[model samples]
Target: MTDPSQPEDTDPDAEDGFYVLHLFVTGASLHSTRAIANLKQICESYIPGKYSLEVIDVYQQKALAEQEQLIALPLLIKRMPLPERRLVGDLSNTEKVLTGLGLSR
Candidate 1:
């Protein structure tokens, strides 16, 4: 049972809102590790229960990297929302990361 008039209707598929992210890393490098940590911290602190992070090791998953056309290591791609965005780096820049992910600073 649900109310069609309510704008806050609950969707099990997207209950907490959806965030599809792909983190492309070269391997178990410092940058890769930092990017993963920073992104995880940010997501958990700010957007907890509302984000999906997928870390892809380019060395192991070359096909996925090529599919995404990644030109740099440690690239973060926001795919769920419209007008997808991309950020390249270790992901230590909280302001930039938040902004790129359509979040307020």
Candidate 2:
């Protein structure tokens, strides 16, 4: 379903549509590092050039973390393509991450 708050042109079904994703992680944590790699792999394989990923280390950017209300060690936020979504974990499950980001396998 399309989110009413989003612009009509922002179609989630469009293969060429752009996506803005923010990944927040705690500094130096193994899980955080893994999440970053997993997220990057998923984005490259799935969205390719149609997505922008921003990896933010909460330890370095504490203000951003607090502003985004990040309560998890590794958090992924889909900021674009309509209704926002979030997934928190090591991001090892590719299928789950894809689904959470509203993408198909």
Candidate 3:
């Protein structure tokens, strides 16, 4: 379903739809680094030119973290495609990440 808050033209199901993802991680921690790498790899492989990923460091961006209501070190939020989903982890597991992002095949 499409999110009511977003514009109708930004729908993820559109032929040229783009995913908007937010990844919040603690600065330079091992898990954070891994999450970044894993998420980037996944995005490149699965959604290549069709996604926009924003990486935010909680240590540096406390306000943004608070806005997202984060309660974990490394968090991934699928902000588009409606029914936003949040996953907390280093994102090392491909299958799990794919499923969480609704990209599992």
Candidate 4:
């Protein structure tokens, strides 16, 4: 009952699909800058093109922040791949952040 011409699906969580992350930052503060750098490093080293990151500055878009129920200055929301997750602060903890985003090895 399988098509020989089609490639086999090898990913275990392929059904879950990729992830979309929304990073909420208050301003161009140190924490926000660090969060962006750290997140970029992690994603590039581990997940690569498996996810997408959308950075939103609350200082510029306070209404969007309020809509997402953001109460912290730097918050990362994993919006896709099922079982949404949130992480607050500068995102310095690589393991914790990766685990939260379901990208940990």
Best by lDDT: 2
Can you give the TM-score per candidate against the true fold? 0.82, 0.84, 0.83, 0.82
Report the error of model 3 at residue 1, Å: 12
**What tens-digit string does per-residue lDDT give for candidate 3 at 6-93?**
5544334532466789999989999999999999999899889988999998888888888878888799998876557789999999
Find the candidate with the highest TM-score and give its number: 2
For candidate 3, the TM-score is: 0.83
What would the per-residue lDDT of candidate 1 be over residues 1-105, giving only the tens digit for each residue? 666643332233332457888899989899999999999999898789788899999999988888888888899998866447899999999999877776642
Count of backbone clashes, every candidate in sequence: 0, 0, 0, 0
lDDT value, residue 58 of candidate 2? 87
Cα lDDT computed for each candidate against the true fold:
0.81, 0.84, 0.83, 0.81
Worst 10 residues of 1 by lDDT: 6-15
For candidate 3, the per-residue lDDT at 83 reads 53
Q: Which residue pairs in candidate 2 collide?
A: none
lDDT, candidate 2, 52-99, per-residue tens? 999999889989899998777799998887668889999999999877
**Full-model lDDT, candidate 1:** 0.81
Residue 54 displacement in candidate 1 (angstroms)? 0.6
Error of 3 at 48 (Å): 0.6
lDDT of candidate 3 vs native?
A: 0.83
Score residue 91 of candidate 2 by CA lDDT. 94
Candidate 2 weakest lDDT stretch, 10 residues: 6-15
Candidate 1: residue pairs that collide: none
Order of the predicted models by TM-score, top scorer first: 2, 3, 4, 1
